[model samples]
Each structure stands twice: as structure tokens, then as C-alpha cells.
Target: MQRRLIASVLLGHYLSAFTALGIPLYLPRILADLAPDAPLWSIGVLFVLPTLCTALAAPLWGRLADRHGCRLSLLRAHLGLCAGFLLAGFSPNLALFVLALVIQGTFGGAMAASNAYLATQLDKDGLARALNWTQYSARLAMISGPILLGLLTAQGLGLELYRWLAPLPLLAFALVLPLPADRPRRPARAAGSATTNIRLPGDLQRLLAVQFLFSFAMVVTFPYFVPYGEGLGIANDALLGLLYSLPHGVYLLALPWAQRRAANPLGVGLALLALGNALQFAIVQPEPLLALRLLSGAGMLLAFVGLHRCLSQRSRQGGAGRLFGWYDASGKWAGTVAGVSAGLLSQGYGIASPFLVACVAACAALLLARPLVACPRELPA
Candidate 1:
């Protein structure tokens, strides 16, 4: 029954992500159609707006879930996402569209809510495993979302598909209805089971910091990645799409192995990420760039697995809804800042400049993560 619930959550996560992921990619085009005279920076602002709002709103939602139930929170996210997408689809002007995005970000925190819901059903190790599966579902969505969207776009359905994606999350909502409700567990039960007795505030702060830096570094390079690739001389759309999906592919293939084998996955992952980003800035040739991209992907797998392990352990102590809420907020805030910074850096310096910034952030994250591994209670070998 637990496995079935996990499977349902994974499926819901993938479907929602697969349908909604294309919006960011298609934003510029969507903006062009809606407001041809809009400034370039507005596109960036709009792109980041939802994330910014989500960061601000997630904690409140988390508290709500803690007070109510995670199952209810999960249902709310799916319905909220559906409403937000519908609003965006029907908006007649830019102002209304911006409002739609605000609604979307403010209420569409399904990932965090889902993680919190899962925390109710699993132990530390089992929660870690479930988180991995959730990440895999997201990675799979990233791999397939664009391809499917591209096919539909090519079919002359065009922008209408954006509106149509609004209903996908409802399928996820229905899936959640049959799952058992989340009941609160006693603190003693969690304390008795946990392998580590983590001290709060300090440990939690470090985790939040790691999450922030990890997100900032990864997302900082995303906005202008296509332009950077084009600068490297890859012109074919199909090939470019393949190259773009490489890191996600690497995650799909390598994360499970990394989770099992790496003794200090977070430390090693941060090191690889720093190296990959730094080297990427120096290398101009397509082949070497591809290699570095693969290296970065490897780093992503280890780093994400390590982080999820820590998160799972922490979430076990009850009030998981609130904990995961803050956790997701940190990452969302990082993404919001990263998106804005990428646009600025790309415009002022060059498309490749953000890679250097990402490298610096990764190095900072590496330094920050050292203490985490050194503290035996925080992470498993």
C-alpha cells in the first residue's frame, strides 16, 4: 500500500511536471504574442515572478499543512496549479497574465507538499529512497517534456496547448484521493527510530544554505544555455535538444549508483560541480564542453542524492510539512535570484559568463558542505 502510494505520487509528479515544464521554454514566444512591445527584462521578470512568489508563500502553506493535513495540502496544490494555468491561458492582457503566474507560484508548491506527505509514511532511509524516485520522475519529465511539446507545437496547435496543460494536475489530484490520509506521529516514535540525533538551528541552517547554493548554481546557467551552445557552433535543433537533455539523462542513469556507493556524496558532488562549471567557462570546443556537461551531470546526481538523504532524515521528526516547506522555499528563492542574475550577467558580460558565476557558487557550496559530512550524525555513509 505504501509502495502504491509512492508510485501514485511519482506518476502525478511526472505528469504535472511534463505538462507544465514547457511554459518557461516557451515564455519568450508567449510574451511576444501577448505583448509585442514588452521589454526584454520584462520577460526575465515574468519568468522569475512565480518562483519569487512561491518562496514567499511556501512557508505559510507548510504551516497550513502542519495544522491541517499534508493530504489536504497536496490536493490544494494540484487544484491551485490547475486554476493558475487556466487563468494564464485565458488572460487577455499582460497584467492578468502576471496575476496568473503569481497565483501559480503562490499555490502550486506540489513538490514540497508531496515530499511532506511522503514523510508521513516512511522511515529515514525509506524517505530518502522515495525522494530519489521523486527526483527521477522530475528528471524524466525534463527529458520528455520538450520533445512532446515540440511535436504538438509543430502540429500547428501552437499556443493553445499551453491552456490545455491546465488539466494535467487534476489527474494527479484524483490519484491522491484514494491514498490514505496523513496522521500525525508522536515525536517519541521518530526520536526512537532516527539513527542520528541532530541539533537544531545550526544543522537546519546549514541544510538551508546548501539547498540555496545548490539551486542558485544549477539554475544560474539555465537561462542562456541555448545561446551558449549556439556560440559553441551547435546549430541543429535536434542535436541541441539532445545536448540540453544530457545532464538530466546523466541523473537518470547515475543517481541510483551514486546514492549507494559514494561515502561523501555531497562533498564529492559539490567538488565535481565546481570543477565542471569552472572548466566549462574555459573550454570553447563542442566535444570538451560535452564532456564537462557530463561531468556536471555526475555531480548533480551525487549532490542531489546526498541532500535528499539529509532532508529525509530531518523530515522524520514530525512537522514534516513545515520542514519541507521551508526547504523548498530556500531552493525556490535561489532559483528566483539565479534567473534574474543570469539575465543581467548574460546581457552585460556574455552568455558564458554565468557559468563562471555558477562555478563560484558551487565552490562556496562545497566549502559549506564540508562540515555536514564531517558531522557523522547528519549523513550516512
Candidate 2:
């Protein structure tokens, strides 16, 4: 029973990670196919809008997890994702594509729901392990999603297939819902539908800020890397996907180790995230190289794993659902901004610039993370 619960949580998080990365992985092909006529700015907007929707919807989903339960909420969110991404495959215009993305974005709470479920079940040590597993799942998805999408697209599937692919993960996710609802006295009140009942604490404002800064620094790389690779003579499609997946592949392998050692997970994540960027900076030659990016990916995984562990620790209160919603919201918003900014900048300066900016952003986050380091909760008291 315990092992099943852990598997469900891990698989659920992996599925959500697959959903979250779909756009960035497929966006270029999507724009070329569906919105070829749209301006670069408009394409960027289509990218940002869904993330914006996720940012808005995460809080609601988080609360829904609190009032009802995370498992059911996970099922509901997956249903939303199935519908949204399916529509995206058949979307004929930028507007409809944007609509599908918003739908996907709104359902992005699958991760939050999974987290809330784990938070409720796991004690501190358990929560830490569960979240470490969650990080591993994300790295696996990041590696797998692109490779899978690339393969599917290779068979003339193009990018629209995400529409169909999106539904299956959630459908699989729904299979695990039984564990959380052992008693099954579900709320039927309309007011309790998707909105959260738990309130976020005002005192944790600084924590949220640190979370936001960390995500902001890291998210800037999403939309720009593929295009950057293409520009730098990465002509083989398989190689391109490999280049993108390598860093995450390395990260996935190391997550368990990091979870064991970090005393202050968030602070450690922030500092390492900054250092990861610096490593990227160190590789900032005149062009983008796949090998260097792989190294960067390893650094990113370490940093992001730390960040997630910190947030898991922070979300241990009764308002955990609310906390997760806000945490996810910040990451979504930060990614949206970074994706758009990278898109615009890529229209001119090329790929090295976005990563360079990532380095700077990480430094800023490190400065903010100092307080978290100094005042960690689980100190040797």
C-alpha cells in the first residue's frame, strides 16, 4: 500500500512534467505549422498565455486539493488537460492554439495536486524523499517527452499529436486516485468545486519571493535552446533532441543523492541554481554547443531539485494546498516571461544571450536566498 502510494505520486508528477514541457518542446514546429503567419511577438504571446493561465489556475486547484483531496483534483485536472491538448492538435489558428494552451495551463495543477497528496501522507522525512522522487520524475519526463515527441513528429505526426498524447498521461494518472480517497466522503457543495478553502500565510511572503526568483532565473532557457541549437549546425533531428534531453538525463540520475544531503533544501537549490548558471556562462563561447548544454542540464537538475525540496518543506502546513498553488504559479509566470523574452531576443541576438541572462538571473536569486539559508527551519537545535 505504501509503495503504491509512492508510485502513484511519482507517476503523477512525471505525467505533469510531460504536460508542462509540451509547449516549449513543440512550439517551433507548432508555429511553423499552425501559426506561420503570426508575428514573432504573437507566437511568443501564444506561448506565454498558457503559462499565464496555469499561473492563474494553480491557486484554485491547490485549494480544491485542500477542501476535497489531491487525488480527485488530480483526476479533474487531467481531464482538463486531455481536452485542452487534444484541441490543440486540431487548432487551425493562433487563437485556437492559444485556447488549447490555456486549457493545458489551467490543468497544469496536476503537479500541485500530486504534491498536496504527498504532503498530506508523508512526514517530513517522507515528504523530502517523495519530493526527491518527484524531481527525478520531472527529469525523466523532460528527457522522455522531447524524445517521444520528436520520434512521433518524425513519422509525419507533426506537433499536433500532443493533443492526443496529452490525454493518455492523465488517464493513466486517474488510475491512482483510489489511494487518496480511502473513505470517499467527497464534497458535493458547489462552492467547494475547484476553489481552495485553505488560505496562504502572509508571513511566508519572503519564502514565496525566494521561490519566484529562483524559478525566474531558471525558466529563461526553455524557449530559446532548440532554436539556438538549429542555428549552430545541430542538423540531425535525433541529435537535437538528445542535446536537449542530456542535462535532464543527468539530473534524473542524481536527484536521490541531493535529497539526502541538503540541510536547507531551498537555499541549497538557490545557490546551486546560481552556480549552474555560472557554469553555463563558463561555456559561453561564440556559439551554442550540445556538450556544454548537457553539463548545464546536470547543474539545472541539481538546482531545481533543491528548489522543489525547499518548497515541499515549506508546504507542510495545513495551508499546503494554497502554498503549492502559489509556488506553481510563480514558476509558471516566471517561465512565461522567460519564454517570451527569449523568443523576442532570439529573433535577433541568438541563443547564447538567453543563457547568459540565465546566469545573471541566478545570481539575483542567490542574493534573495540568503535569508532562507540563515533562517532554515530544521536547524540542529
Candidate 3:
């Protein structure tokens, strides 16, 4: 039963990842079609809009999930995605398109929902493993989604892909429907349960700080990555897409080993991320830069997995739905800020400048890493 539930969650996440992570890749194209005269900064703002909405909305959803059930929250998110995509696909004007993005961001947050649901069933170690596999699903999507988008674009499907992508969440919605209900029973809690008033522990606070910084460092590089590659003179779209996804490939292939061998995954991962981003800014050559990106990918796996492990340890203490909600919001907020910063940096400095900024953020996050690895004492079961 546990195995089946885990599989369902992972598969659901995999399906949702296409829209969450992959669709953003085509934002530039989508903008070109929908709002041809949109300014350069608009892409950055638009790219992060959904994320900002998610950050603001997730905690409220989390509170609802804590009161109701995570399965319902998860279902709601999928449906939200379906609606958001359809609206965006059919949008006749830029204002409507922007509204569609707002709806998308406001409603979609399946990853947090999935995490909360899994936390209800799994032990700390099991939850960690499940979260790791969830990341695997996302990484796999990161690799395949772009390649597929590139192929569809080559066939001249063009912006029609948005319409094609609309049904993906419906498929995910169907996939998650089979999982058993995971809400806490009404009888189990007092009438005035303080689910909404739960406070973050010191360790979790540190981790959230790390999450924000780490997310900012990583995401700031996303907005201009393809353009940066083009600036480096790598013109093959397919090859550029592959290079962009190489770090995730490293995560899929190397994470298991890092999980077993790393003494302090968070710290080590941050250090590597800082190093990789620094190298990316320093080195302009495509060949060596590709290899160096793997270093950053390796760091991503360790840091993220380590963070999840710490989170799992804390989930039961504060209620998974609320805690994961806050965590997701933290990361989303970071992505939002990073997007704005990336736009400003790219406009003022250069496309490559975000990588340097990312390196600095990663280094700053390294300062908060000690609490994550050291706070493993058992909480109330």
C-alpha cells in the first residue's frame, strides 16, 4: 500500500512537472505570439508571476489542507493547472494572458500538496527517499519536457503547444484520484485545534532561510540561460536545450551515491553550487562549462535532498500541510525575487551576470547549512 501510494505521488509529480518546470522554457515564444511588443523585463516578470501567486496562495491552501485533506488540495491544484492552461491557451489578448497566468499561479501548487500527503504516511527516512524520488520525477521531466517542446516547435506547432499542454494536469488529476484519502479525522483533534497557529522551530527557520537563498541562487540563472548560451555562439537549439538540462541529468544519475556518501549534504552541496556558479561566470567556453554545470547539479541533489530530510524530520511536529506550505512559499518567494533580480542584472550588466549573482547567493546560503544536518533528534510521532 505504501509503495503504491509513493508511486502515485511520484507519477503525479512527474506529470505536473511538465507544466511547472517545462512550460516556462517556452515563455519567450509564448510572449512573442501573444504580446509581440512586450518589453524585455516583461518576460522576467511574466515568468515569475505564477510563482509569486503560488507563494502567496500556498499557505492559505495549506491551512485548508490541514483542516480538510491533502488529497483534496492536490486535486484542486491539478484542476487549477488545467483551468489556467486552458485559459492561457485561449487568451485573445495580453491582459487576458496575464490574468490566466495569475490564475495559474494562484491555483497550482501540487508539489507542496504531494509532499504533505506523503508525509502523512511515511517515516522520516521513507519520506526523505520519497522526496528524493519526487525530485527524480521533476528532473526527468526537466530533461524530457524541453526536448519534446523543441521537437514540437520544430514541427511548426509553434504556440499551439500551449493548447496541447492543457490536458497534462487532467492526466495528473486522474492519476492522483486513486490514492486513499489522507486528511486527519475530525474526531482526532479538539474543536479549536491550532493548526493555523503553528510556529516554526529554530531549525526549520534556518532551513527556510537556506531554502530562500538557495532557490534565489539557482533560479536567478534561469531567465537568461538560453540567451546566454546563444551569446556564447552555441546556435543549435537542441544542443542548447540539452546543455541547459545537463545539471538535472547529473542529479538523476549521481544523487544516490551522494545520498549515501556525503557527510553533510547541505553544506557540501551549497559549496559545490557556489563553486559551479562561480566557474560558470568565470569560464565562457561551452565545453568546460557543460562539465562544470554538472558540479552545480550534484550540489542541487545533495542540498535539496538534505533539506527535504530535515523537513521530514520536522513535518510531524508542525503538521505537514502547513510546514510544507511555508517551505514551498519560501522557495517561490525566492524565485520571484530572483526573477526580478535576473531581469535587472541582465538589463544592466549582461546575461552572464546572473550566474555570478547566483554564486554569491549560494555562498550566503552556505552560512545557514549547519542547522539542517545537525537537527535530527526525533520529534513526537
Ranking by lDDT: 3, 1, 2
Which run of 10 residues does model 2 get worst, by summed lDDT?
A: 181-190
Q: Could you give candidate 1's per-residue lDDT for residues 91-147 as a string of tens digits?
A: 888899999899888988888988989987788888888888888988898778877
lDDT of 3 by residue, 1-381 (tens): 889889888888888888777778778888898789999778878878999999999989987777788888899998898888899888889899889889988999988988888887888888887888887887898888877887887786655676898888889899889888874533254467845334445466787899999999988998688998888878998788777788888889987876675455888888999999998888777777677878888888888877777777677733677788888999999988988898799999988999999999999898877756776644564
Clashes (N, CA, C under 3 Å) per candidate: 0, 2, 0
Listed in order, each prediction's TM-score against the native is: 0.91, 0.81, 0.90
Q: Residue 292 deviation, candidate 3, in Å?
A: 1.1
Deviation from truth (RMSD, Å), model 1: 4.0
After superposing candidate 3 on the true structure, give the runs of residues whose Cα lies further than 4 Å from its correct spot: 185-200, 230-238, 262-264, 284-287
The top-ranked prediction according to TM-score is 1
**Residue pairs that clash (backbone atoms under 3 angstroms), model 2:** 63-196, 85-163
| Candidate 2 residue lDDT tens string, 212-261 | 66676666776566666666666676676677677767677676666667
List the pairs of residues colliding in candidate 1: none
Residue pairs in candidate 3 whose N, alpha carbon or C atoms collide under 3 angstroms: none
> Which is the better candidate, 2 or 3, if ranked by TM-score?
3
Sort order, TM-score high to low: 1, 3, 2
Write down the lDDT of every candidate, Cα atoms only: 0.82, 0.66, 0.82
Off by over 4 Å in 1: 184-202, 376-381
- Higher-lDDT candidate among 2 and 3? 3
